[model samples]
Target: MTKEKFKSLMQEAGIKSKKELAELMGLHYGTINNWGNTQGYPTYLNNYFHFIIKAKKYDEALKKGFDESEKPQECPSNVEALSLENARLREECEKYEALKRALKEALR
Candidate 1:
């Protein structure tokens, strides 16, 4: 999502900053900032997008007086969220690998 949309999500969720939202949604502070802007690679960007979407869905459900525990949650569960985060970490690793290859090429 665009920075403005992400910011709007934060507002709609009734939070002030990424840190607060992170705490509320159990997301890493960095993940929220990554959503705010491109951090490095857009590898797991979709995961964050899905996460925010799910959170919004959950919030909407609550507002609608739905019982979340008995209902099917379209949002990413804990495992799914972790899996998405793993994709992000893998992307970070790839960047380092690319840098390493560049260094090796330079030495050659």
Candidate 2:
């Protein structure tokens, strides 16, 4: 693969830098540095493009969890939930009061 494509794959697979990638692969930093200078990767990393795609898919899945999407859905916490319930109840109480007043007026 081209050097840029190789670097892009590394990033897409979550290795943000050459040093980090080396740490992940248990290799010396100079090895990766040399590969960059030569504009090529070792066969191992060169063969890794497909694995990068898989890694990206796995990473996305892990981040999504059971929600099954790239971004997390915002769920209300207990306090927010109680606040929403309180507002709903207050609206219902107002409706009940309005109905009671209308009934009294009709009985008059």
Candidate 3:
């Protein structure tokens, strides 16, 4: 989701900030903001909201709980997408390292 839309969702759900949402999914602060901007989140956090919804027994139940002076929540899909993106970024870094090693070997 776009940052604006994500921010809107938080507002509609009565959430305060990305930090709270990230904490709900056991993520670092700014994780949700990054996900909203980049369309990716952590895999472990993917099913976080699903669990919360199931535990609460309604789509908005968790939100309601949060609205009632509790904290925010994280959704599974967002977390999964972000995890994939993070893995992809890690792989890219590995490739860069390999290329650097190869270049050093050639120069030597």
Candidate 4:
């Protein structure tokens, strides 16, 4: 991956600087900095950064209640299925809480 692309991915993942990326990835700051002056970032880093970006998106979506309409259409089938299941589980939890509340009110 080109240095520019790596930086872009880091930014997309909410990483502000090479130091932050290095800390998150558990690498030395110099190692991350060397990528620009060396041959280039390792090819695997491309996948890693992409994964980080996806995870960030998923985390944000989860925080927003994992609404089905908010799910990305471009996600792989497995990811899509997981998102659906998460939505289903959230619904179940809501139902359970409502039932618990009703039962408590009845007992009272």
Candidate 5:
């Protein structure tokens, strides 16, 4: 990725500076600086940043609970279907959290 796009992604992911990102990724600050000055970031960085952003959204969603306005109107008429959908959503959330943890461990 280009340095500018990398910086934008970092900002979107709530990473304030290149040094902070370096710390999170277990890399030297100069290594990150070099990417901006000379070599560009690896292509995988795009996916990594996107994952971080999505993970942050997941965290917020879990904390606030699902938005009622986002729920389907017809769910109220079908209690069984609603229960089944809730269970499936919970399972999917668990899987996402597990994958996020695994990725963090691997990065370290």
Candidate 6:
């Protein structure tokens, strides 16, 4: 990948900048530029990319959990309220998966 495209991927992963990527990858800042411009970049980052993708998935799931928790609802009975909450949580999980797919497509 071109340096710009690599940088863009990092940005889409919420990396923000080369320095941030370096920090996350535990590499020297200069190494990011080298990888960005070189053929070996993908090879070097292959395992790391897997982790990054997993992390993104985890983040989406966490956000969904939080969104579900934030919603306010009322039910006539405690059991009914618990059931409603469970359904909302399930819907949020699905939404999170959808959001991740959309993000992946947009980055591509």
Candidate 1, TM-score vs. the true structure? 0.34
Candidate of highest TM-score: 5
Q: Compared with the true structure, what per-residue lDDT tens digits does model 4 show for residues 6-102?
A: 7788888889988998899899999988997965778788889889989998898787764556665545677889999999999999999999999
Q: Write the per-residue lDDT of candidate 5 for residues 1-108, one digit (tens) a residue.
A: 776798799999999988999998899999888886888787788998999999999999875554556665555657888899999999999999999999999999
Please write out the lDDT profile of model 1 over residues 20-55, one tens digit for every residue.
Answer: 866866878887677545664245544655676788
- Per-model C-alpha lDDT, please? 0.70, 0.77, 0.65, 0.85, 0.87, 0.73
lDDT of candidate 2 over 1-108, digit per residue (tens): 668887788766777788987787788988878885765667777666568779789877776664625434443355588899999999999999999999999999
Model 1 misplaced regions, further than 4 Å: 39-108
Provide TM-scores for the models: 0.34, 0.50, 0.34, 0.58, 0.59, 0.50
| Candidate with more favorable, higher lDDT: 2 or 4 | 4
Name the candidate, 4 or 6, with the larger TM-score value: 4
Q: Is candidate 3 or 6 superior in TM-score?
A: 6
Q: Model 4 TM-score?
A: 0.58
Once superposed on the true structure, which residue ranges of model 2 sit more than 4 Å away at CA?
A: 62-65, 68-108
Candidate 1, after superposition: displacement of residue 77 in Å?
Answer: 44
The per-candidate count of clashes, in order, stands at 0, 0, 6, 0, 0, 0
The better-scoring model by lDDT among 4 and 5 is: 5
Worst 10 residues of 3 by lDDT: 68-77
Instruction: After the best TM-score superposition of candidate 2, give how far the Cα of residue 41 lies from its true spot, in angstroms.
Output: 1.8
> Can you write out model 6's per-residue Cα lDDT over 2-106, one digit (the tens) per residue?
566666567657777778878887888887766745534766565565578789989998887557446544223566978899999999999999999999999
